[model samples]
Target: MCFSASASFVGSAGIALVGVATLMQVRTPRTLLFAAIPILFALHQLLEGIVWLGMDGRLTPPWPQLAGQLYVFYAQGLLPVVMPMAIWLLLPSGERRRIVPFLLLGASLSAYNLWFLATLPTDIGQCGHSITYHNPRTREMLVAIVYVIATCGALLASRRRWLVIMGLANLAGLTVVALFRTWAFTSVWCFYAALISIMVYWHFRRERMARHVEEAPQDHHFPAGNGP
Candidate 1:
């Protein structure tokens, strides 16, 4: 397998594990939304693997082009909006207000990017050890800034320590990719984000266990039919 394929496979496996753990404890709409992130990311990684095979000549003509476009669709068209929206949903109502702007920005950007993707051509190629996805519409600095804010800002604004850590890790990864490997930003950063998603599973599982512990004593003190 190629570097891209290898990386994508590893990422997909990690996210799949997180997805299982997430499913085990999801108890609310917000938790469901949060749980979906790993599955979405796993799909994203799998699509990238297809793109890799396409680029490597392991797949036929139009297939590579199609795979490339699909990869771009997720990286540029869906992720900005999905990331912030998921984070916003996971936050408390009071804290959610602070993330509203990010969610709105992400939605607007995603809409525009999806339109751009539909009308424009996307080019994908291998660069050094990563893949570079080219779409002229997404090259502007303003878009870059807003993309960061929409994706990273929501995570950073979270009251959860784990989410904050994930946000900081992603921010640092994005900064490094932007500065040193701008061409491979999408590929590299997605991998980084997928790795950090493990923290999300940890956060959810820990919270669920803590809640169970808290409820155990209460359940013991107050029998099913007893009331003060």
Candidate 2:
């Protein structure tokens, strides 16, 4: 009925869908790790949206007698940064064995987020917009910087041109977020990441197709023994 509720519901649903899609496609550690990023971020945004919708306005500082702020700090501030790091670190070696665990873990975290939102008051400030002492959003932004660094380093190690491009773009976007505190370009980075993911996926698929093509029997019309 409220804007915050609607946004939160939509955001949460979208993230859940992403998690489901990722579950269907995750057949490798890299995909699992990569998919986890969007999945977690989507859920984080959804939860924040939920808080916004439920409250119907900005939450006062030290809400519900300070426990509210603490809750917000952990849920909105910490989990988004933590979950992806966990998935990236603990991801299985191969896709087949990982599907169940990865899906279960990711889904569980998302579900927890959903449940947490459902139970809590919607009155919380956006992470970095706080005017109080217990602000955690700033720390979360710094955490995001760490993510950009690690992701860029990984891209360089892979030596994939598309990855390098995407990695650099993402780093640039995060830098913009850090410095200007605006995210007009961050939306562009999201699209860029999606494109890069598709390109890398298709690139590998094409390589596999080429291998198949090469391995196929050639129809060379050689005169049986004369060729030998």
- State in Å the error of residue 81, model 2: 7.8
Q: Model 2: runs farther than 4 Å from truth?
A: 1-19, 29-31, 57-147, 182-228
State the lDDT at 210 in candidate 1: 89
lDDT for each residue of candidate 2 in 104-216, tens digit (9 for 90 to 100): 44444445544544565434333333212122233345444444544444444344465456556656655654576443222223333433444344444554567789999
* Global local distance difference test of model 1: 0.81
Per-model CA lDDT versus the true structure: 0.81, 0.44
Per model, state how many residue pairs clash: 0, 3
TM-scores, all candidates, are 0.89, 0.47
Top lDDT: which candidate number?
A: 1
